[model samples]
Structure formats: C-alpha cells, structure tokens
Target chain A: MIAVLGLVVGVVAGLLVRPEVPAAVEPYLPIAVVAALDAVFGGLRAMLDGIFDDKVFVVSFLSNVVVAALIVFLGDKLGVGAQLSTGVVVVLGIRIFSNAAAIRRHVFRA
Target chain B: MSDHDRTNGHRFRAELPAEVTAPPSAAEETPGERTPAALTGRQRLVKGLWPPRVTRAQLIVALLLFGLGFGLAVQVASNSDGDSALRGARQEDLVRILDELDDRTQRLEDEKQGLEKQRGELENSSDQAEEARKQTVEKERQLGVLAGTVAAQGPGITMTVQDTKGRVEADMLLDAVQELRAAGAEAIQVNGVRVVAGTFLTDSGDTVSVDGNKINAPYRFKVIGKPQDLEPALNIPGGVVQTLEKELATVTVERSSKIVVDALRAAERPDYARSSSR
Candidate 1:
C-alpha cells in the first residue's frame, strides 16, 4: 500500500513540478525510463510470487537505470549512440512484456 | 534392545493414522512441517510466492514504479507538444514547406559546387596569373553590364505607354521599373536613358525625367530579360499594365526575340573607394 502511495505521489509531483530536464541528460531519459519500467514489472511479479525483497528490488532498479544510461553514454562516445539506445529499449521491452504476462496470469489466473 | 526399540518406534509411527500424527492447523501455520524434498518444483515455487511476505519491499517497488510512470507521462506530454504544430498543419502546406526547404538546400549545394569548381580551376591552371587576370576581366565586363556602362541585348518585353491624357506620373513609372526589376529584368532603358542601379525618376514639368534626362510620352521601355517572366509581370492583375491603363494610358507589351538596351552611362571612377582585396 505504501509502495502504491509512493508511486502516486511521485507521479503527482512530476506533473506538478514539470521540471525542465537538463539537455545533457535529456537523451538518456527515455532509456532510463524503459529500464525503470523493466525493474517495476519485475518487482510486481516478485511481489505476486511472495518472494519480493526490498533490497533486491531497490538494487535492481538502481542498477538497471545506471547500466542503461551508461550503455547509451558509451555508445555516444563510440558514435553508435542511436543504435545502442534502440538495442537497450528492445531488450527492456521484452522483459517488461514477459513480466506483464506473468502478472496477468497471477491476477486473472488465466 | 536399543536397536529393536528404535525400529519398533519407527514402525509404530508409520503404522499410525495420518490424521492423528499430522494436524491441519500445524501444516497451515508452518510450511516447514513437510520436508522440502517432499515438495515438487511447482509446489515449492507456489509456497515461496504466496502470503504477502514483506511490507517494506512493496513500498520501495511502488516508489520506483511511480518514478517510471511520471517519466513516461512527461515524455508523452513533451512529444505531443512538439508534434502538435506539424500535426495540425494542412497536408498541402506541409508539402509546400518541405519543397521550399528542399529548394533552398539544392540552391546552397549548387553555390558550393560552383565555388569548388572555381577553386579547382585556380589550382589546376598552368598559367595561374593569366587565368586569374582572365577571370578578373570577365568579372569586370559583367559588373559593367550591371552598372549600365555597357550596352546589353537579350530576349525580353518592350512596354510602350502611349499617354494621350498625360495622367502617368514619375512615381507610377518608377513603380513599373521596380516591378520589372522584381521580375528579373537584367537591363532596362526608358526612352534613350539607361536605367542604371542609381537611376532616379522625378517630375519635370509635364514630362518625367529619368536620371535628369526628360522623357516624354510615349515612353518606350527596352527591358532585357526573359520574355515569359517579364510579360506576365507587367500583365498580372492590377499590375503595371492595368495601373497605367486606368489612367487613360494605352500600355502595350510586346515580346521580342531580341530587345536592345543601348543607352549607356559613363563609368565614373569613385574618388573615395578603393579595392580592399590583396
């Protein structure tokens, strides 16, 4: 319940603040968002499965965002930023889908 | 005795009924009551998953999800805002804008290629000084034509304004000159006076003066340029022709294979200006 509340608060704050993202960080935001989503879905699945661990979820979320941003930053330095970003998004998108499927099975029992 | 007793104890427990030995409440409360080895893979997975384990973990996960949702919404909002202008534009307008951009790019590319060709010629010429001198002479001739110091001939339109009522003013004639220039007239002559870059028209009594040279009606203009462009420019609705005709003047535009602008201006040397190039 607190977790859901925290999520709601975060969304409300973001909407209300509407802070301008720094230009340097702007390119990595979308990839970071995708990585965050992957972590969220994974956490939700773990929660449903009763194996939800706070330490594990926090670490995964942090590491996912950091690693995803790092990969994009590295790709930029290597002059393959666009291609690498696409790859990151694709991989994260697949993970999100599978996690969603698992959630669906847990909730709907179908 | 000890071995026999222990064997009998095991046999006694095995022989006992399941209901008496294992209670349902105990099984429900402590999942550890059954050995882990007795549980299948699926059963173990289910056992690990059920019964809402930790509150703190849920809170943290929710917080992370909240952040993700916020970022997603902001991204969506920004994208929509950026796209709204182009999204609302008419297809024809969009296509025209795109075409204009393409035309500008093509023009720039052509200019770049021309410059590159000039540089290549300068580099490849065996007699570089001679080549440069030749180019300078060619450039001077082109400048002379523009300055109205040399006569020019081209395929263009001849506009004759026969003003019987004398309603045409100097300013009206000036307007006509401006319109022709906009339509890409390379060289223009009013009567026998050359219309140079600094040519000015003023009312001198009943006649209009072109650069202090009085030209009386019928004022004949020998314009050197593309006939198709020059003719339409004069004949456009409410253009020079219609404006002149409204004032009781007969404006006739004749397209010719060749129109000669023979009136020339003396090349005046500038006393104050000098070539800044090395």
Candidate 2:
C-alpha cells in the first residue's frame, strides 16, 4: 500500500515540476525510459513470484537504464544509433509485453 | 487416502507422522503448512499474487516506473506541441505551403546553378581580364535595364486601366506598379514615363504623375516580365484587378509574346556617393 502511494506521489511530483531535460541526454531518454519500464515489469513479476528482493530490484533498475543509454551512446559514436535504438526498443517492448501477460494471468487467472 | 497422502506428503515433510496422527482442524490452523507447492498451480499463483506484498523493493520499482511515465508524458506533449500548428492546418493550406516551399527551393537552386555557371566561365576562360570585362559589361546592361536608363523588350503583359470616373488615384497606380514589381517585372513604363527604383507617383488634380510626369487615363502600363506570372498576379482574387474594378475603373490585362518599355531615365551623376570598390 505504501509502495503504491509512493508511486502516485512520484508521478504527481514529476508532472507538477516538469523539469527540462538536458539536450545532451535527450537522445537517450526514450531508451532509458524503455529500459526502466522493463525493469519495472521484471520487478512486478518477481514480486508476484514471491522472490522480490530490494537490492536486486534497485541494482537491476539502475543497470538497465545505464546499459541502455550506453549502448545508444556507443551506437551514435559508430553512426548506427538509429538502428541500434530500434533494436533496443524492440527487445524491451517484447519483454514488457510478456511481463504484462504474466501479471494479467496472476490477477485474472485468464 | 493414499493419493491424498502422496499429494500432501511434500506439505508435511518435516512433521509427516505428527500431521498424519494430528486432528485435521489443528493441521489446517498451522500457517507454516500452507506451502505454495502443496496447493494447486492456479491457487498457488493467486496466493502468491494477492494480499498485496508491499516490499521495499517493490516501492523502489514503483518510483522508477513513475519517473518513466512522467518522461513518456512529457515527451508526448512536447512532440505534439511542435506539430500542432501543422496538424490543425487544412489540407489545402498545407498543400499550398508545401508548394510555396518547393517553389522557393527551386528558385534558390536555380540561383546557385547560375552562380556556379558564372564561376565556371570565369575560371575556364583564357585571358581572364577580357572575360571579366565582358561579364562586367553584360552586368551593366542588365542593371541599366532595371534602372530604366536603357530600353527593354520581353515576353510580358500590357495593363490598360481606363478610369472614366477618374476614381483611380496615385496610390492605386502605385499599388499596381508594386504588384507588377513583386511579380518579377524587369522594366515598367506608364504613359512614356520610365518607372525606376526611385520613381514615385503623386495625385496631380484629375490625373496621376509618375516622377512628376503627369499621365492621364487610360494609364497604359507596358511591363517587361514573364507574361504568365504577371497577368495572373494582376487578376488574382482581391488583387490589383479586383481593387481597380471596385473603383468603377475598367482594367484590361493582356499577355503578349513581346512587350517593349522604351521610356528612358537619364543616368544621373552621383552628387555625394561614389563606388567604394577598388
């Protein structure tokens, strides 16, 4: 219950603050967001499986964002940024879908 | 009984004999015996998912998700804001804007090509001074045509404004000249008076004066430019033709293969300014 409330509060604060993203980091933001979403879904799945670990969740979330941004940065340096970002989004999107499916089954049994 | 014992055997692994011998009610009351594997798969899944385990890890994950959602929302909002004007524009307006942009690009491309050609000629010619001199003369002739100091003939339009009611004013005639100039008029003449860069018009009683040279109706405008562009420019909706007609004046615009503006202005010597180029 407290966790859900924390999420709501974070979202409200973000919306109200509306911070300007730095231009240097703007290109990586979408990739980072996708990576974060994947981590979130993975965490939800782990919680449902009764294997939720605070340390594991925090580390995975941070690593996911960092690695995703790093890949895009490297791709940009290599001049394959667009293709690499597409690949990253596609892979993350698949994971999010599968995790969502698992959550749905846990909640609805259908 | 045997099947029940076999399925429930894993549930009572530590206290198998005690659980077998104990009362069923007492066995059911113990929380430790409710192992997930002991229940059916569906029931186990439900049990694992339900009664909301709000762990610290889950709270952190939620916070991260909140950040992700906020970023997504802002990105979406900003992207929409950038194209909102284009999105709201009508199809025709959008097409017209695109056409205008294309026309501008084409004009720029033509200018670039022309400049490149000039540079190529200057570079490839033997005796570069003679080539430069020739180009200078050609440029001077073009400038002279524009300055109305030399006569010009071209495929252009002839506009005759007959103002029987004399409602046509100097400003209206000035508007026509401006419209023609905007339509790429290279040279213009009204009643044998040359219209140049410094030409001005003023109301002189019942007639109009072009550079103080009084000209009466029908004001015949011999304009040297592309006939196609100049004619339509004058005849466009709410344009020069419509404005002139509203004044009870008769306006006739005719496209011709050749139009001549022979009216000349004297090349005046500069009193204060001279060419600064070496």
Candidate 3:
C-alpha cells in the first residue's frame, strides 16, 4: 500500500515538475521505461507470493533499467540498436505477461 | 549431466507418493515434516526466485516498485506529448503518412505552376499594350511635324525672289505659298518666318508681312518635301515663278538635299470643338 502511495505521489510530482531528460539520454528512456515495467510486474508477483523483498525489488529494478539501456547503447555501437531494442522488449513483455497471470490467479483464486 | 540421466531422474521423481512430494510449510508444526534434502528440484527453483518471508526487504522492494511505476507513468506522458511521435508509429502508418504528404506537395506544385502561367500571360498582354502605345506615339509625332507644330528637316527646294522693280505684292507671295502646299510641301518657311495653316500675309508697301513679321525684298523661301516633286512644281509652265518673273522680279528655284524648317506653334485647345462619336 505504501508502495502504491509512493507511485501516485511520484507521478503527480513528475507531472507538476516536468523534468526534462537530456538529449543524449533521451534515446534510452523508452527501453528503460519498459524494463521498469517488467520490474514492477515482478515485484507485484513477489508481493502476492508473500516473499516480497524490498532490497531485492530495488536492486532488480535499478539493474533492469540500467542493463536494458546498456544493451541498447552497445547495440548502437554494433549497428544493431533496433534489433536489440526489439529483443529486450519481447523478453520483458513475456515476463510481464507471466507475472500478470500469476497476480491474476492470486487475486481471483481461479 | 546427460539427457538419459536427466530423463531417468525425472521418471523416478514422478513415481514418488503425493504425501512425500508435498511442499514443506515453514509455519506448519508436524511430526513427519520433510527435511531440506527431500525437496524436489522444482520446489528449490521456486524458492530461489521468491523467498516467502516478510522483513526489511519489503521496504526496499516497495520503494523500487514505486519508482518503477513512476517511471512508467512519466515515460507514457512524455511519449505522448513529445515531438517524435513518428518513433512510436507502426511501419504501415508511417508509409501512409508519407504518401499523404507527397500528394499534398504535388498538389501545391501544380497550383504554383498554374499561377506562374497566369503571371506569364499577364506579362505578355502588358508587353503588347506597351508596343501599341509606342506606335501611337510615333504616329502622333509624324502628325505634329506635318501640322507645323513641330520642327522638320528633309530634302526639298529653296526659292528667292529679287523684285528690283518693287512690283511684288503680298498676294503674289501668298499665291506662291499656296501652290507649294498643293504640291505636298511638308514644311515651309519664308524669310525666316514659319508658314502654318493659320498664317496670314499682308502687303506692307515695299515689303511683305507673313504672320505679322515683315520680310524685305530678296524674299527667300525654304521648303521641305520630296526634292523631285518640289523642283518640278516650281518649274511648271504658268506657275508662281513664271507669274512672278512677268512682274519684273527675278525668281530663282534651287533643289537642296537638306532643308530645315525650324518652326513651332502651340497646339490649340478649343473648348467648343469637342469630337463627336461620328
């Protein structure tokens, strides 16, 4: 519940302040956002399973965004940035679907 | 290890009883609780990924989840509001948009071409009107020269009358001037005085006055016309030279290649002489 409250507050603050991302880092924002989404789903599933670890969630969330951006940056150097971004999105999307399914089962008990 | 050993191990695990295969509950107090060694590989795998414990870890996990949710919201907002909407568009949508833009450009180019054609036609019509105006101005200049309101120069004849007997009258000079006019004289001057349509001559007793200017004996007349026609007109039998010679005056006519008639008259602006349509 506190986590949900923090999310709402952060969103409101972000909207009000409207922080501008630097031009150099702008290319990575979409990928980082997708990675952050994967971490949120994983965290939700963990919370539902009664094994929600704050340290693990924070570490995983930070690592997911960083690693996703790093992969794209490296792919750009290799001239495969688009393909790498697609691969990352596909993997993260599958994970999100599975975690969402688990959360649904826990909530509905079906 | 190998595929065969893995298959055999899976088969043995499948043969275990339901009670032996059940997961160990940490909270349950039972006498026949299974040891950690009795846990299956699947159970261990699940435990590694998700630890069923509520502790300080929840705080860190919750904070990170909050951050993730915030980032997601911000990303969504920025993506919708930013200038790079094409980055999120599908390939087919981008192609359709490009086609529409090309069509619009082609239409604009055609419109511009049409306007350019119209401008060209307008310029052509204006050029024709200017040419016509120049021709009219040239016609007016020729008319002004003939009417004696403008100066004129051309091949013609000059005549001089030496009336040693003082018998030459203004009427006789007037007759000579009329004869030149009938023979198509473009311009004429008598004794430094211009001759025009409104010119009047009078006998001034031993002199002739043309347009209120008196000219003495040795009356020289400069006439501008076709030299062939003017010289023949003066030499015609019973013409002005013959009549003037009978009056005891020596008349001489000479043809010249260039004769100047520098005379100007102000054009009349008649308030009552408006042109009728007929």
TM-score of chain B of each: 0.53, 0.53, 0.65
> What does candidate 3's lDDT look like per residue over B56-125, in tens digits?
6545555665666666666677777868777654445677899999999999999999999999999999
What lDDT tens digits, residue by residue, belong to model 2 across residues B116-221? 9998987777568878899999998999998888889989989999999999999999999999999999999999999998899999899999898899999999
Backbone clashes under 3 angstroms, per model: 3, 0, 5
Q: Flag regions of model 3 displaced more than 4 Å.
A: A1-38, A41-50, A53-110, B1-89
lDDT of 2 at B26: 46
Off by over 4 Å in 2: B1-55, B83-104, B107-278
Give the TM-scores of the predictions, in the order they appear.
0.39, 0.40, 0.56
Q: How do the residues A30-75 of candidate 2 rate in per-residue lDDT, one tens digit apiece? A: 7888887788777665554445556677777788899999998898
TM-score of the A chain in model 2: 0.93
Please report how far candidate 2 places residue A71 from its true position, in Å: 0.8
Q: What is candidate 3's lDDT per residue for A1-110, written digit by digit as tens?
A: 44555677777766776666566676687899888878787766554444445556676778889999999888778867778888999998997786666555544433
Q: What value does the lDDT take at residue B256 in candidate 1?
A: 99
TM-score for candidate 2, residues paired by index = 0.40
List iRMS (one decimal) for every candidate: 14.2, 11.0, 9.0
Tell me the tens digit of each residue's lDDT in model 1 across B1-278. 11111322332322233333335434554565665434332344466456545565655666677888788766656556774556433345577889999999999999999999998987788578888999999998899889988888889989999999988999999999999999999999999999988899999988899998889999999998888999999999999999998999999999999988899899988798898996
